[model samples]
Target: MPELTQAQRNSLAILLDSREERIRAQMDAANVARTVSAGPEASDMADLAEQGAEERMDDAVVDHYRAELGDIAAARIRLARQTYGVCLDCGEPIPYPRLQAYPAAKRCTPCQRRHEHMHAGPDGRR
Candidate 1:
């Protein structure tokens, strides 16, 4: 793949930096939700059930945010390695528009679609 122009690289770097900040803030919110317990000492069964559900939901949110953070970190590493826009699967350049939309994207659209197809079920269930 050709080298990204200086301006393109700069724009991508700025986008990645902003993305990191948003992800960190979201992760912080997730952590806050995880830490706050709803009716921890409730005696009612319904309250207990609600609390359990809330905890489960909070855990899911935390896990999702953590996964996003991992992706952002990997993207940042790729930027540092000068491989940010190259697709890992096909070694093709991912379009700038796509990168602007998803800074952590690691593959070109076709390759990414193929990967998803292979990983997903016939019904597109992941």
Candidate 2:
């Protein structure tokens, strides 16, 4: 199992906290925009159409952030378990630099490369 140094743990905690805050803010903004766009007489046709499109985009963005936050939360749990830097695919220790760059990553470079290669072909034929 891969174990993070105290400093690395602290760094990951900070990054996760920042990402959580950002996602929360975005979700809040999206909610407010959605509410404003949903009321009666809020229809200026052009404005309404644009707001609808923007709201849909915001929903998609929120979904993406939610998924990312889930990954971050899972990473945090793995950190607490002292398994934060181990590759899930190969059971190898993930590189420290890669961990710094992607704290939520679940695979080492080689395992990730092989996984990507295995899934690269169209229609999942590989």
Candidate 3:
């Protein structure tokens, strides 16, 4: 936003890199766990249940990590285009603090709230 100040860009980039590194490490660990936890050599209901739980947990972690990676990739593209920190729906510059908290944010607070509301289910969950 506003061409993103040099300091802001550096700070955001650092944050992105740190998050990316953490997620990548998590993916690696999850992959290893997936391999190791694929099954228990001993066949028993208890072992099968434990393995199933572990696999489910690893699946959740991988799903989350992939989503974050995709968001980071899109954010990087915006940065390259000099549009990082700009609200996609409002065409306004999102605050630096907001960007600091959410480097991949594509909408300002108000717009994001409205969007969530619009997309929320009848039970008022988004």
Clashing pairs in model 2, backbone N/Cα/C closer than 3 A: none
Tens digits of per-residue lDDT, candidate 1, 81-107, equal: 988889999898998888888878899
Per-residue lDDT of model 3, residues 16-64, tens digit only: 8888898899889878877876654748889778777877877877887
Ranking by lDDT: 3, 1, 2
Each candidate structure's TM-score, on Cα atoms with residue i matched to residue i, is 0.82, 0.71, 0.81
Q: Residue 34: error of model 1 in Å? A: 3.6
**lDDT for each candidate structure:** 0.83, 0.81, 0.85
List the RMSD of every prediction in angstroms.
2.3, 4.1, 2.5
Off by over 4 Å in 3: 1-3, 39-50, 122-126
Better of 1 and 2 by TM-score: 1
Q: Compose the digit string of candidate 2's lDDT tens values, residues 69-114.
A: 8989999899888888888987888877887787788898888888
The local lDDT score (0 to 100) that residue 91 gets in candidate 3 is 90
Worst 10-residue lDDT window, candidate 2: 35-44
Minimum summed lDDT over a 10-residue window in model 3 is located at 33-42
